[model samples]
Target: MKSPETFEHLVRAEFTPKSTFLNTATNALLPARTVTALQDAVRLRAEGRPLDPLYDDVEASRAAYARLAGVPVERVALGATVTLYTALIAASLRPGAEVLTVENDFASVVNPFHVRGDLKVRAVPLERLAESVGPDTDLVAVSAVQSADGRIADLPALREAAREHGARTYVDLSQAIGWLPVDADGFDYSVAIVYKWLLGPHGGAFLAVPEDFGDLVPVQAAWAAAEKPWDSAYGPVAELAHSARRFDTSPALFTYAGLRASLELVEEIGVDAVHAHDVALADRFRAGLAPLGHEPVPSPGSAIVSVPGLGRLQPELSRAGFALSDRAGHLRASFHLYNTPADVDRLLEALPG
Candidate 1:
């Protein structure tokens, strides 16, 4: 077993080491390496280092995510948010076609389709989403891990279901990508925001586009999406990139500074190892909750272990310094690499039996 220090040791001591924090579903604590990298980048900029040099950080981050997903670098696009990528996917759908998804998923997934009016979006319950997909369904959208209940979707089954009906699949990996070793074979596109499980700054996300993209336009094109951004202008609209690079959100330069380091850090630790750690902690959390008469919703397989109808207890836990999320009647505890057994003990001690 890798020593706990391999991952946890580098977390900043600035975070109250005495307190228990498990709100990764809401956001994650920045590792000390990422914090230091952000600080150093700011100092370098103040010392007259050209912002142009920092631009490469975007490419570096893309490469890092590409490596993590075992895809070619060209298949990865750097962006500011998962919402933007979902919107971009919506741009490619046929007008008035059906896009099926769960209602409780983050709005970014389904709202884009609703606002466009080009697609008929059905916001239904998770259990109904897969069953609802049919030949008329242009796309089936879901998070690999449900946001509120921590329900891990059976991707293979969902993919098979979607394929049988001639529909495209899109997965938002905001909750499960880093902590679960997800493969792209099932979905045509997968988007993830780095600030959550990725442990990066807010303005960073990635879109894994289809490798066999054909007749797929750059949904919402920016100048950076041009085939040759530096050499071209608004004169004649340059060709959109053939690869996923065309989806780049034209983010701010500083956004990539901290993200590059964080993505690389996740790569170093490896996704499988992270998944094991998260699952083990979540199982431990569930065991503790058993005696408390609390149960995780949707059977916990992901890092997020939420107890239904426990929302009322959130205030008491918060008062004890246990950071968590209480939403829609579920009290959520999201674990990550930095968490330990002691942290879980702290929480169990605080909870009323």
Candidate 2:
């Protein structure tokens, strides 16, 4: 485990954002090492060198992500987006199956099931989600941390509720993974895009499923999903992978090359350490908000703080070099390992009274 001082020092050395970047809930700034890896990948392609290393990077990321998510690599599938993975789950659902979701959650988690047209989709407030699960609910899908206001879902309660109702759970970890310690194995299915809190490049996502691959059909399967990819290249997959790899979407090679390095940094610092660091800064920001006459959205134990009615200040804050997001008229500020108390205080100082 890295000591707090060492972790802070590592973060300071690795990230050099020109702005006080506090929008990690929206996207993360790549660390210097990841940037170097991406540059090397591009150079390799430009120089017509062997692309073998890039493929190695993809496998390396799969292993690293599996470790981070606390699941066997066989249960993890590499993908380009959360929506594709969610769609695969949606496809597996029988007609008239019901999906319970959090109201106003990220669209990627909710839209796919609704688009199916035949499935019964229901949305409820986050606090009421666990209790809302019923015998008719086939799946309970929600983000671990809500994107708009950073409210954390009650995963344990949801898990218990789903189990009691004979329902499966699907969690989107895009806004939670790096800073939040999640056991992906707890869910029947989970998906995350690593670009946000995982600090990887866009186009890299992961899906974790049961060891038996659940009921998914891998409707988007390609050569890469075959048991023997190279041998099956010219024809339809001779045999789909027995594991969750059958659900994989062809990886974006360059994205994985950078992601390998980013995941390495995350491992070194550790998620628990990052969580402590992030939530402390967010609390500091939250405490300061009231003095500035701004009351933030109630989100205890979260690294993202959203102040309702402060959306108008976002453009001015951006111009002042404080990076954040304005979502549905709420100014959302997210903290991560790279953020410090000074960053929080400076943003507080910049807020209008």
Clashing pairs in 2: none
lDDT computed for candidate 1: 0.79
Q: Write the per-residue lDDT of candidate 1 for residues 54-115, one digit (tens) a residue.
A: 77887888888887666788888877887887877887777888888887888887788889
> What is each predicted model's overall lDDT from 0 to 1?
0.79, 0.93
Residue pairs with backbone atoms closer than 3 Å in model 1 (clashes): 96-118
Off by over 4 Å in 2: none
Query: Across residues 179-207, which tens digit of lDDT does each residue of candidate 2 receive?
Result: 99999898899999999999999999999
Global Cα RMSD, each model: 2.3, 0.8
State how far residue 31 of model 1 sits from its true place (Å). Answer: 1.0
Q: Pick the candidate with the highest lDDT.
A: 2
How well does each candidate superpose onto the true structure, as a TM-score? 0.92, 0.99
Write down the TM-score for model 2: 0.99
